[model samples]
Target: MIPLTLGEVARVTGGQVHPGSPGTEDLRVTGPVVTDSREAGPGALYVARRGEVADGHDFVDAAARRGALAALTNRVVEGLPCVVVPEDPDRLSARPDRPPYDAVTRAFAALGREVVDRCAAAGGLRVVGITGSSGKTSTKDLLAQVLPALGPTLAPEASYNSEVGVPLTVCRLTEDTAYLVAEMGASGAGHIAHLTAIAPPQVAVVLNVGSAHLGEFGSRAAIMEAKSELVQGLVPDGLAVLNGDDEALVETMGGRARDVGARVVLVGLGERADLRATEVVTDERGRATFTLTAPGLGAPEPGLRVALQLVGVHHVGNALAVAAVAHEWGMPWEQIAASLAAATPRSRWRMEVTEREDGVTVVNDAYNANPESMRAALQSLAAMRRAEGRTLAVVGGMLELGADSDAEHAGVGALAARLGVDHLLTVGEVARPAATAYQQGGGARVSSVADRHEARALLEEELRAGDVVLLKSSRDSGLRVLGDELAGVTD
Candidate 1:
């Protein structure tokens, strides 16, 4: 990054400087803000992001002790003068506005953007951002793996798809990067637009719209609109890889993106899909092995049927989207097939199976959630629960879903019941409704818990040797706790 003077940062981001004086001293900065002081470096800028339970400002002293050059905050630090913030979570969260966040934060962002902008300044960054309720992480992982064979690629770690994450990824970009595969996730409006504007991908993939943050966006239509921002914000000569089966997105892109410069590439099993799938099969392990028939290219004879690692039949769609992105980048068909066929999803909670003692299968997919992902995981369990193995669902509440949160939780419960899960254990207050709905929906024995620890405590005692369990929930519920708990005991 080009070292910027404190004055240049103020000029660029219009932030307030403390001590009422400015220095031309330049600080070359890199890296995104992580709370752990150990990650902070000599020139690191620390941002105090506020969450429900923990306020990062509380850690500023710890941050300063770790060699943080500057701390962005509203309060004071003993060693470092705070960059007083205007204190809006969303905006201060973004590019660090002044009167806003501390000058260091803006300066840091400016430095990072300067680096990425410099790389893309000559022509453009061959960026391809993906945003959808269900398949973002999977799709991003797929593209990063497949595109590298064609060119150097960089995608965010896990689901780092947010206001702060997008800019941070942009700042991380070096000229050597040929593909920046970003997953753009949002709660309300403007985020997708903001992030999409930052990446300005040449090819934007809208995987599939699902009941993700319905509470935040208000409705499915709103979610669709928010997700569409990725494709809509595409640069001139950009390609929009759409899901042909997603009626909401297909109609919207077909209706509007044509007016913009975006070139549409439809991907789905539907016959109308530009990149279609055929002869899809799921193995005994619940991993989808599909043959991709992309009419967009030609010769529909044999589709690609690689063994997908992620444990969901629905992820066939995600694989297809990655194939589309690889194809769009001019990667040869055989190479695309090889890259995708060889690709393995980075494991967290998505369909992670652990074999506990006795004969149980632990389907540990305790990551973030929306209605669509919940249904997909449940379906995975339903399909695998057979062989006389009991299907157990350990579910937690989904967050950030505004007013629709309760109904969405209820919907999850209903889905679990309809899937005929052997046992349902709902954790968190929001998931109580789902538990209730599951019982009412003629589901198998339904149980409720106050939190994940309680659920684990019960599972430790109740889980039998021959059951197939599915643990799923939102990030806030800390579903990983269950995964770790199961991982610890299942062995």
Candidate 2:
């Protein structure tokens, strides 16, 4: 992070330098700011948050022993140098259930905003905010690979797209960092807006509005409103890159960009898009190859061909969004295409294809799942099926679908059967509906297991050397652990 003295940090966060740390106000924090004491190092400032499992205040001494410069806390630490943000009595009375450490969280957010503002003023750092129901992480990974060719780029390590995650990501920036890719996710209406306040983007990309959080947002229309907050937060001279094929995004977010005085560039496979894919085709391995055309966005008349190493045909839209952002930054088409083609998946457990010594192929996409992503993964697995081998799917429950959970799960099962999956194994009681639907949909071989162990045992008994298997479910379903074991991935 950009170095800041304790005095400056205290001022920025609306905290007071405790008397125990008197005369230490000039001490500068030069290391990373971390919430976990285990991650604290020399010059690091440890943020003492109160979590449900354990209180961060309990780790103040541990952080001090690990070379931490100071602790940002709600209560003053007796011996440790500290910046204390006291809880407001008014808020406490207004909300009796509010945690006392909420003050510290608010201070931490303020500190993150200050750091980002300082970095942008110092080196002209460009922030790119990406949000979608499903594709945020994948697109962020693609941009992380492509943006570095132009300048020093820092993106969140994985799916760090929450209120705390966004601020933590911003606090990692340095004076020399040129681009920041902030992946924003939302479970409710105001979630994305809260993240955007911390690191407002010069370029915002909205991939799609889908049913990933249908239960929390209540409806697709509400999800669209939440996703549009990123566009609404764009700077006056900012650019909004949206998926034109998603009619809701084009109709709503396009107007939002205009309202904010930001230019909009639509990307997709449709002819209405300003930057679109043409002649798209996916190989047997499900990797896509497409010609990129963007006459509306000022590309050369000759279309650029892009070949992606990613393992899903749906990624053509992701690649197009990356191409749009890179093109807007004046990156040549050849460089962008080469970077995308050479880029491999950086994050784990999403369309991760692994082959065993016995030649069985496992597509481990069990990181998380919703109806849209589940259908996409199943289709990608079907595309990889060999004539000699059977296509099998081991799936678990998709959580947070509200009243539509059963029907959505049934739709996924029906799609898997229609896609010619030879064997279907549905794990957990929540997923039994899918098993029932698959059987009723004329799937010849189907099984319902109580847990991952039963599913694994069934696979071991029935899986053949040439058979291809897909592991897919929500993160909480524990299917990723089974996928890791099957693919021989450790830790």
Using TM-score as the measure, the top candidate is: 2
Model 1 misplaced regions, further than 4 Å:
1-11, 14-24, 30-38, 47-64, 69-112, 122-124, 386-388, 402-406, 489-491
Q: Please give each candidate's TM-score.
A: 0.86, 0.96
> 361-476 in candidate 1: lDDT tens per residue?
88888778878888889999887865757889999888877887888889988988888898999988988999888999999798898987788788888877668888888888
Error (Å) of candidate 2 at residue 190 is 1.7
Candidate maximizing lDDT:
2
**For candidate 2, what is the lDDT?**
0.88
Q: Model 1 lDDT vs. the true structure?
A: 0.73
Error of 1 at 219 (Å): 1.8
